[model samples]
Target: MASSLTKGSAATGEKTFLGHPSGLAFLFMTEMWERYSFYGMRALLVLYLAANVADGGLGMNDATAVAIYSVYNAMVYLLALPGGWLGDRVWGARKAVAVAGVVIMAGHFLLAVPSTASFFVGLALIAAGSGVLKANISTMVGQLYRDKNDPRRDGGFTIFYMGINLGAFAAPLTIGWVGQELDWHIGFAMAGAGMALGLLFYFIGFRHLNPVSSRVPDPLSAAEKSAVVRKGLVWLCVAAAAYALIGLAGVFTINYALWPLTVLGLVLPAWSLLRIKRDRDLEPVEQSRMSAYVWFFIAAAIFWAIYDQTGSTLSLFAKGHTESMLFGFGFPESWFQSLNPLFVMALAPLFAWLWVALAHRSKEPSTVAKFSFALVMVGLSFGIMMIAQGAAAGGKVTPMWLVSVYFIQTVGELCLSPVGLSMTTKLAPKKYGSQMMGVFFLAVTAGDSTIALLQLCGVPTDTQSWFASQGALAALAGIAVYLYRKKVKLLMRGIH
Candidate 1:
């Protein structure tokens, strides 16, 4: 293990994989397998719950299944708050991630045991573990390159993004096929194995990590340290309140709840902005950028609300309505999940090139422009699905319907997701970057939770109706984007 660690470090420092750290490859492959396990399990979730008792699965109603899926997904992102906080405030990124991996590995193992008690227990572990690993790992990648001006940063992120999708692409096919066709336990067990591999690689490559990478310095002044602790506690209270409200409200009522939770989420940051405005501790430009980060968070949440349906409503749509076939061969329904990642791998380099070219010419779109475009592309993807809905209502739509939809959406992701990550790192004040990353992941949490919330609200589980609803929701989201375009652009001013 020590030898492997040394070898990996040497490789990472010496060669840039596609112009960034070879360590990027290490992170990429680790994330890929982790995602494969994650999405692999995800593809099985609804099917498992909704399947008959004789199928070696839990027979749950579609609404309940989706609701559970949403909560689980949301928790994964929600944990990022504590995970990132711990990295910034206590353990640092490397230790936090290692601990998270172990917890997840244990969680996956619990699931493989085949009991209702174990099942929920496994999910709880997974959620807690994900909270630790998910947010910090991305920040660590952003840490790798020294130059904020390095043209390779975006491409590196895109490549890392591809690894995530590649895992997603393969997971459903491999794990989904085994679980659905052979034994569900087989797929569940594979997820555990995947995590073990991820942990193995991550630990072996730990030495390659730069000491400066996300190393939170000891708070210089007692006052500063005290402020961080206080702020962190405030966030903890806020997250608890958010979760409490969700539990108290019925699933359908969660949408109404978002307004208040959204307000609550921003309270501290807003207060910080006011302080900045007063010139209490920060400069005017710094204050503006901090305020801009808050707005970016809002826009990001809105985007994820539309994008994250891939795991919930979209997953159901692929299974139920869309035709899944390649020539004479019928592809596993879960395999369709790969389209997003597949397109991501293909287009990431191109998008990376486009951004650099435009930046060089002073023709690059503002961060807000990039964000708006991401929303527009996401809407366009849904628009195509709406067409597929019409076709499927008549009969089976071609599998290409889903593929083509994922293709367009992947373009939107290339615009939105990784750039959103970059935007946070760039726009946020240095003292607050990790925390801001945590906040960014929170948007993902809300968006994912919203997907399940919608499913519980009215999204159909039956074949034809579900596709139609996806189209309608997509249209609504697009309208929301159009209305918010100018507001989004205003936030870009403080961003470089």
Candidate 2:
């Protein structure tokens, strides 16, 4: 990996790190460990919730557990809005990400304390922290590559993504297993350790982070300075109001209060962009693509809602109805969570090659085709679930069934997600590139939260009926993608 970094750097005249900056490696490692902690926590969450109180778990009912899971997952991506705002208009990306990492570290430490109060507090802090790190880190990655048309851009993201999966692939099998088989706090402590490693790397390589966008003030022209102050005050007021309301409406569910704010959060940006288009100098294509990017965010959110359920409903599915033994080798349930990232690591290179190969032949499918494929694969994963249900109707369901489902989902992810990253970079106006990426991730927020909500509504773990209902939604999403495939394709006409 270091060799690849050096080789890319050499190729790029040694100005950038492995064609980005040496600093990129620091960010990569930081993100890798952060994901390790996050995915590790995720792998154990459902099992931890469903575990009996006698087994040192909370013994929460599936519905309530799933709801919390959904909200937490949703907030992970949703917090990016304010995170990016802080990075762009307040502190800058690097500082925001660093601070966010610290916050996440604190969250993990809270989980290690082993109290119900600490658990909720820890989750809230981690969610807020992810909002900061998740968006800004990617922005820094883009900053490392000064050349917009650099051939290494896609490869760089691929490399960065691999780092993510490295942590993801290991976390579940290790931290999750230890947590489940022994103590839950041990897993959380492991997560906290991972964050510490990430923070260490960030500080160690801080000097290499030149050209990084900071949240600190730049030497601005008169208009730019005024704009910054105005936006800052607006965000400050909004945040204060939102916090005040949260405190006042203590009886209301956090999700209920937050969802409305989510809407408000979205509209605020839309209003900003509308004014930009109406009054500020803008390119037509840039404006159009930005609009399309918003729609894509909605679509992406839907996908995540279905996909991220692995941590909530699907984890339970493996534990409950699915027969997880093979030749008397009963697989660890947390091990199942490892499959997605493992497949991603295994197949990403092949897909990257395939995409390039297709492009060379002038036969590459449009971005919409890739997205349609993603929806189809998502439906197919659930279809496998449906089949597993049928196979297990009278007896144990084979572990192969769930494995097949994860494999299929991974393929869908390969087609849709990495490609979506490229698409986001292509579509957003230059000024809003990082913010748009943040917006693209909002789909994850909606998707993960939606999954959690489904679980809470008694559709995921407690009842086989609820689990089966997911198949119907997956099917509908596939149909919707198919029906609108052409229209979506039209939006991508000039993106590539």
Candidate 3:
């Protein structure tokens, strides 16, 4: 650990970029373009699937398209477990990120080809590639800052996060317009080009990166590697056999295909918690911290389940139930997807300043309290949507209603998302730090999988009922968390 710390510190004295390390700038740009490709594709996916075949779409039903969307998103999260392990143990973060970029670009290109087979194939590739890239890239950012106590760490991360939002904010307006009004395949091609540009920048800036990213932090012994390979082959064979059986039974629908992933979503967190609990090497304090994180995990899952609907259910609502014309010019439904990230970019600085101001005055809310507030805010957004349903003009509400929903949800995201990341890092046992991060992402997987299953069960067919139920549940969950805050704080063992 000390040696790792020493390696991290090596880059500290190097020249700064925008008052931070230069490597961060490279990472920031790389992640920005990657997110551009990702959110661009995301903004189009459901709309493309549900649109009529005559309109250059697959003509899938809303339920099917949404289920596929959920499963794809869920897989992207689930595969991060192996993805991060591969980076740490086999390929190193640098090589893993590079390979992921290539794979993701290929996925986007495949989507640009305009065949049903290519559509599923493209989505599979994107999910797999994003899994490999997402966790490891962030890990590389941490490697750039050697001092754990560096006051600049939080601000650096804020800057990096803004890059993510920048990409997200731009992709929807550009790619969304192209896909909705021009050509769907052309939009996918643009996404591929965006990733290609990101890769080009990565190659150009590779030399400036910290050396730690270029080598595996933990390499397995040759014997252990051999054993892992043998086990992997066994699992592969088992999966193949199961897939064959499912195909033979003629039950290979989107919902059925996602059943195994949904099961894994439920099982993975349990397995992670059990492993943490049974680890004899962990100190009692470490065990207690892990226990506290469990509550956070659950809360975060609920929050994301509501927040992530912006790309799926909300996108659909904007398309069908919202009036898109402003000043007699109709805009693309996908354009509405940009609202959250745009709001995020605009509001994040104010929220950061507010937190610091409150802290200075010794009046800041506890982390758990902030999470509760996030839930309530998200619930209120849904409640507003429920009201909007009744207030629709000629079966279509104004786009501002959904825009307002995104704005409120962005506030909730500001409270929960960064705080959750900070809490995970603080509460994680040193030995299991990376795995704990993987578990945190599983919270997202849980939420995506849960919502997907609900959609499959026709829960979202009645938008009014769906919004009302989600709003009520989220609000109630917030109150429950607030009530239980004292117990959670005790379990936190002094971690604020």
Candidate 4:
């Protein structure tokens, strides 16, 4: 919408790749390596933390390790709120992305150093950089289109999402092997190198873009900047005080440390929704659409509660409850982390075509309907996991069980994730673009909160019931979404 090239004519014309803009190709490559860096390090995080110091790990307990991993993962998403603000208001999205890349690359390099201090510092930097990069890069992908109704939109997003899996599919195999089988720092260093290459490709192909992201969506005035700085310091102090209180009370464990962040995971999305709905600039239709989005948002939260796309939990499951042996060779548990992304790489193009083909026949499911179906897929995936867990009580089950589960979730992911990305861009207010993208990611954070709460309270002794209860809840939520799909569509005010 900020295009300098005649309403994004350049975006749809001249250079093209796979029937879309060539800029999509550049973004695709960039995202591939960024995700490569992310998932690569993510695959090894909990394992490294839980490993013995004799093996060059911190040797933390299972609960602490898992809690830290979940909170770290959730924070990476929660920070997207501020990241989006900076992208839209402080700097242009393009500039924000480039700077965030440097931060992310630096973070990975730091992790390569293999020290306790270095590890924490590295995680902080990567989380902040990732939060910034994730929101803006996705926003940039949306900018490559002409308008909300562009038929190329979903397909283009699927391609970009495929880029994510391309990296995810490969990183764990390479980085996970090095981290788990060799040296952890070397694997982290490899992640850094991946990010650096992403930066190189991004800068080399910068001119391919339409420069639509160059214009700030909303620039803060001098008065607003001063106000923001003042407010920021006050909140910073409040945070420090609360953190100190946790230490003073002598409950400064990882479980307690996560309280603020997990609570933020819940509070921020709700606050963002209420604030958006209250915006005076919104037309009646915009208000209606925002209201409609609340259902999608909540449903997505429920879906992610069962999804946990990080694979950390499942990697642990694979380590203990599932076998990684094939013939005479054994593989690391992290190898299972690659399954979801590999399936995405194989399935995305098909799903992309399916949506367009359905659209041509006027038989395409509404976005809400697709979301309903996704919930059911995840519910069913968990049902299988429940059975697998029950089977594990007898002995380690076949790896195919986990494989089947990832395949089902991948189907759910193909239905919801990329479509959700495209849908957010469609529904965003003209002025609040990047921030709205950030709000969409909070679904992941909200899901993290739910899981973290369950984990911290205590592990459930009955693993089957644990899985069954969650699976049934997801099935019920799916039915509820299906029942309300018609009303949700009406509230969309013609978005479909």
Candidate 5:
């Protein structure tokens, strides 16, 4: 009966697009352009920082550039928790997304200014604004369905996912070209322009969105709102005090501050888990499922730590170690960033079909097993890179070497990327459902910070040793998870 109601709700005389709510079309387009601005700026950041001072770049060494990128990248995901909180309790998702887009556009324009101080400020703004947009938009997509059981939910999200990649794919080719061939600031301005265009598009089509877009998911009472504000103020004071102490200790540099901030960011997830574990209302099955999720979280973090190098370490390899001439014409190495998304568009459907075919034969792998496979495959990609490193010792290796690496990693991504959050939804307790996805994104934060931490510790990612070691560790983790897959499956019970 509930399913019938869900079906009926979907059939309301409301406007539809491709059998899904009309909201998806605008949401998809907005997200695509949002990603356009994001990936556009990101593709330039490290290169700009690492380029010679004479070339209008920041002139930082490779290590500093990579560490800075890691911090900014990590924070983008880390702050999503509070972003989600504001969406759930204060502003509605619609307002949150709109306001965040404005902030993001401002950030890109700020980055276009050629001052060091403004650049850092711009990064901070983008990271915070991205958090708000990132955490709430997908939840808004779910809201469009009006019911959890709507069969269109997965298909709708899949299309939305393609939007993300579409933006990522287009940004590098366009923005990368302008940034490399012309003034870098102009490219940044172009990114801001893309976002402006996106926002205009979303506003023009705003009426198509589901009504729930303007309703906060879990609004607090007046007293509760006051309490939340007080709590936020207290946390702010604590953070300020901590910063003062670090300054007094004579270690107040950007590098030192970032590590502490990352540590604090990581603590949120641990606290979230501990809070969940203490929920006495949960049944034994829910507790068991949470335990299984912990392992999944750990494995997913490892995968992201390796996969996200496309913007940092792998990017460096592309610019310096890989030959860039194609048909004797020079091109920007940032164009390589487009490959992962291109592969996603090409292979996602193939993999989608492969999974269904396997399921028909009763041979589909459990989520846990698939996670294991992803870890191993991503690890193997790096292991292949170690071989590429050997080849580079003679001269610049072919771009195909990196292409081959990306192809392998994209395959690995297909194995785990779509599965992680979907499993989070299935496994969450009702009480924590709204916050679980936010917590799940913390895996990305943790993974990016891990790279920064390694860099700070003098473990350069460009080294053959770093590649071999991390690769082997990831593979071993995969093997251990595979060996114990049955045990984790038992905890999940009927979840898979």
Candidate 6:
């Protein structure tokens, strides 16, 4: 690890913001604006796709729109592995992040062009840009902290996370409303402008950033670098050829655009596990820890499958079955998308305090137990929606029900997300650190790819029954993990 603090700087004891480095402020603002662009565009995607052609949308059906949404989101996570690698091996974090901002802005501009071709192209560009940007920015934040064991690390991260929620909370209310009330292209243009502002902020505060942000932690030897470049070019050519062949076969449709991502999502985790299991260099304890991590990955995938409906199935419910009117003024359904992040901003501090209080009492839940709790909470959130479905007045329920669902789900998120990241860092063998983080994200990719596949297969679309089924599965998974928590904890070799 590289520390950029001056000899007498905060790493040596001088206090900055909340006793941390000043660079955190710049990172926080940059991420806040990046997320503003990201969530702003995401909030409008499905709605824009499924709207009537006369209403400035592509006139896609719900299933098709949901399929696209799942694939695109999956790709965002799925590509992070390579994105992180590129940052480590080719471009350092600072330059990679800068290029990502430019690419993302270009994507939004492409969306502003009103055509089906442009829409898909824009989604592709945005997904690729986000893949490059998302993981690197978080890595840079870690680089800002000089001490690995810094007590303030958690608090600083909590503040950074709040910046994420702030952007997410504001995006839907702003860009979402503009897209719904004005023009879809206008909303996309706004997202582009948000990225521009983020880039501007980053450049203005560039001087505060540490030299660590521009360091390549793991540089390749000349021979290895040459081989890697050659392999990359080969794979690029192969992928292009495969796509061309698929299109020529007349089977390439928008609905199947996710197939490539889906295949990779399914295959990558299995490959990672196989590599881990076969690594003779790993000690027995390390192997056991990796085995336990596999279970956590499964549990996370299940949780995400149910939790991610907020962008797909739940969004559809908000459009068709949730009352959007408040005090006689109707609002865009996308405004409801803000509820999750809004609740996060409100509730995260309380959850943080709760965890600390529990820790002080020697009653903090085991990592596996926390994962189980998250699963159950998310399951129960869906159960609430199922019950709300039963109480619908004339087939439409008040938006408070959705609000309640998001609130509970946010609690689940706070429990799982931070813990998952911490666990990955703590349990991964040093040699496999980056690959282990990639595996963690693969869980998200698996969940999203599964959802996309389900949509493509024309799964039964009854909202109530669907929610009920997902809740039941999630609850059962939680119970199973809870039952085996003690066994799993042993495999963790003292890690919490």
TM per candidate comes to 0.78, 0.84, 0.94, 0.88, 0.93, 0.94
Model 3 residue 373 CA deviation (Å) reads 0.5
Candidate 4 C-alpha lDDT tens digits along 102-151: 99999999999978878888998999999989879988888888677889
Tell me, what's the RMSD of every candidate?
A: 5.8, 4.3, 4.0, 4.3, 3.8, 3.2
**Which stretches of candidate 1 lie above 4 Å from their native place?**
1-25, 142-159, 211-216, 219-295, 360-362, 455-496
Candidate 1 achieves a global lDDT of 0.71
Clashing pairs in 4: none
Off by over 4 Å in 4: 1-25, 141-158, 211-217, 241-251, 279-284, 327-329, 425-434
Give the winner by TM-score: 3 or 4: 3
lDDT for residue 15 in candidate 1, whole number 0-100: 50
Candidate closer to the true structure by lDDT (higher is better), 1 or 5: 5
Indicate the worst ten consecutive residues by lDDT in candidate 3: 1-10
lDDT per residue for candidate 5 within 100-144, as digits (tens), equals 889999999999999988888888999999999998788778888
lDDT of 1 by residue, 206-307 (tens): 665666754664423578778887998998899788778767885534344334433433353345445434554665566666666665665566667667
Worst 10 residues of 1 by lDDT: 1-10
Which regions of candidate 2 fall more than 4 Å away from where they truly are? Answer: 1-20, 146-151, 211-295, 429-431, 455-469, 491-493
What tens digits encode model 2's per-residue C-alpha lDDT throughout 316-415? 7777777767898866788899999999988988988898899999999877777767877787777667767666667767788878888988998888
Q: Write the per-residue lDDT of candidate 6 for residues 150-235, one digit (tens) a residue.
A: 77787778878888989998999999999999999999999999988888888876776778888777777899999998998999
Candidate 4 vs candidate 5: which has greater TM-score? Answer: 5
How close to the true structure is residue 280 of candidate 6, measured as C-alpha lDDT? 90
Off by over 4 Å in 5: 1-14, 234-252, 327-329
The global Cα lDDT (0 to 1) of model 6 is 0.85
Q: Alpha-carbon error at 22 in model 4, in Å?
A: 5.4
User: Would you list the rank order by lDDT, best first?
Assistant: 3, 5, 6, 4, 2, 1
Q: Per-residue alpha-carbon lDDT of model 3 for 1-496, expressed as tens digits?
A: 1132113334445567666766777888899999999999999999999999999999988877777788788889988999999899999999999999999999999999979889888999999999999979988887777877877787778889999999999999999999999999999999999999989988887877878898998899999999999999999999999889989998787665667776777677678778886899999998888778888888888888888888888888888888889878988999998998989888989999999999999999999999999999999999998888777635888888998999999999999988898899899999987788888888888888888888767776445788899888888888888999999999899999
lDDT, residue 147, model 3: 75
Between prediction 2 and prediction 5, which has the larger TM-score?
A: 5
